[model samples]
Structure formats: structure tokens, C-alpha cells
Target: MEQDTLDLAHISLRPFQLSDADDVMVWATDERVTKFCSWEPYTSKHAAVDFILNITTKFLWCRAICIGDRAIGSVSVQSYSGDDKARAKAAEIGYILGSKYWGKGIATKVVKQVVEMAFVDLPDLVRLEALVDVENVGSQRVLEKAGFQREGILRKFLFLKGKSRDMVMFSVLSDEIGA
Candidate 1:
């Protein structure tokens, strides 16, 4: 497939809708897209519906990455709850793009947008972090290019797909925005 430069003007981030199910499936069911994600590649449309209606609703802030009116992927900032005061001031950002859109500078651009949006939308938020699988170089690069600092790695931090994995920790503080 011949890759073309994606016009940034065409990219957008908006709240997810049930109508986006078909477009969600375009990436949610692709292993290449889900390889580094915590969830498995969805096997059915019902799962996509479940995600849009159930899963995304739980996020502090979530949006479908769109081109025109079509959902191509998602980006979110999830807050850590409970009585942990330290965790309350921070949120974790997560994002995924369609496999066809990989290497087109889409994820990096979207991540940068999410960082700016998250900080403005969540006033109490002092930090935005992202955890990437050690093997997912593309994702790490995306975070770095978006201005997140590599804080180091967490060994065996998460058990996914039947194995414990090491993850790289990256973060950008609210004061660091545009710095």
C-alpha cells in the first residue's frame, strides 16, 4: 500500500458514539493494533458495542479519533481513584490508531492533542502519564515525540496475554506543557 501524508486539518477527537461501532472494529479487531493494548483483539461486533457503551463511559475523558465523521481510533485520560491522595492529581493517557494509519504521524499528533486537552479539561490534573510495553518501540516514540519524559521502566508491572511484561513509564507535567 502506498502511504500518503495525512493532513492534520482532517484529524479530530470527539466523544464516542454507538454509531462508531463499525469504525471502532476497524482497529479494535486488528491484532497489529491491539498487540500492545491491555485488551485482546475483539472477536465480534458486540464487543465493540460493549466498549463504546460500557468501557469508554468509565474513563475520566475519552474521545474517538476521527477523520471527518468516521471513528478511526480512540484516545483517553483515566484518573486513578480511591483514597490515595497522590494518585488523585495524575491521570494515565492511552491511545490506539488503525493499523493502516500506523507510521503516518497520526498517533503522535493525537497524543499531543490529548495532552493539551487533558490538562485544560481537568484542572486538578498535574501530570499525564503513559505506560508502554517495552517491546512497543512505536508507542514509546509516539509518547516521546509528544514531549513526555522517559521516567524509567517498571519490571513485571502488568500481566497481559498470559505473561508478565516490563513497561516504560513516561510523563508530562501540566507545567511542562508547551515548554
Candidate 2:
């Protein structure tokens, strides 16, 4: 799918631009923001620049979660790699919001929009999943509020920061949405 922008009541989801580096660095470098994330806290703007240039640019579905003119976070739906067509139809969703926006329901709104986009814009998509660190109750609430069902725990699913961690697997199927 082509890169597209989405407008919600309070936020706009748009493609990341070179100018977004500084704003991205604001949260990306914060220890509080990276604590439950898979990657380490970005130590410099250069790292955020590299991420915007390499990773975000490679995915058409990666979006900067913006409030008005500023980007405060990101959301993405990436298809897993596999030769099988069925595998290609399934994608994983991930998101991060700045700590200041944690309890205002922004994540849930962003997630619901992205999930709708996945089913409507990406015709091949059949399933979308999110794996949240088991200890992150806020993120778990966000996923559940967005209509994702907690399937199970993926034991030692990821090596985040410096140690292996368990993740709670959550998913929302196309047919299961709005039902």
C-alpha cells in the first residue's frame, strides 16, 4: 500500500519526514519511553536520524503519531517475512507514545485507526498482532481497548534491553472487528 495520512479527532497519522528527527529524539532518547521497548534508548539525534532514514522509510505503513503539527510517537503494521502466502497475509502491529500522553486514550485511538487501515487499505491482510511486554499494564490496556484479544503469553519471546522477557500476545482478526 502507498503511504497515506490519517486524521483522527485529536491526532493525525502521517509519514515521517527528515524534519521529524528532533521531535522523535525527544521521546526516543527518554529512558522512560524505552524501558518497555525492544530497542535501547536513543543516545543521540543521529541515531533517530538513522532510524527515520533506514527503518521508517522502508515500511510504507510506519506512521508518525502526531498531535497537530508535532510528532510525539509512532505506529506501524509490518508483514512478517515468509514465502507462504498465508504468512504474508498476517502482519504485526507495534506502537509507542511519549510518557506525557500515556493515560489520555491516545494509544487506543491510534491503534483503532491503524487496525481499520490494515483491514481496509491492505486487502491481503487477515490478521494483525501485537506483543506487549508482560509487565506493561498500560500497553496491555491499550491493546485490549483497541479490540485485540489477549491470546496468551509468549514465554521469553524477546530479548529486550539486556534480558529475555515474556510478552503477552494480542490479536484482532479482520472478521472479529466490530463484532
Best by TM-score: 1
lDDT of all predictions, in order shown?
Answer: 0.92, 0.87
Model 1 misplaced stretches (Cα beyond 4 Å): 1-3
lDDT of 1 by residue, 1-179 (tens): 23487787788999999999999999999999999888999999999999999999999989999888988899988998568887999999999999888888889999998898889988989989999999999999999999999999999999999999999999999999977
lDDT per residue (tens digit) for residues 94-119 in model 2: 89998777777789999999999889
How many clashes (backbone atoms < 3 Å, residues ≥3 apart in a chain or on different chains) does model 2 have?
A: 0
Residue 83 in candidate 2, Cα distance off native in Å: 3.3
Provide the lowest-lDDT 10-residue window in model 2: 1-10
Clashes found in each candidate (C-alpha, N, C closer than 3 A): 0, 0
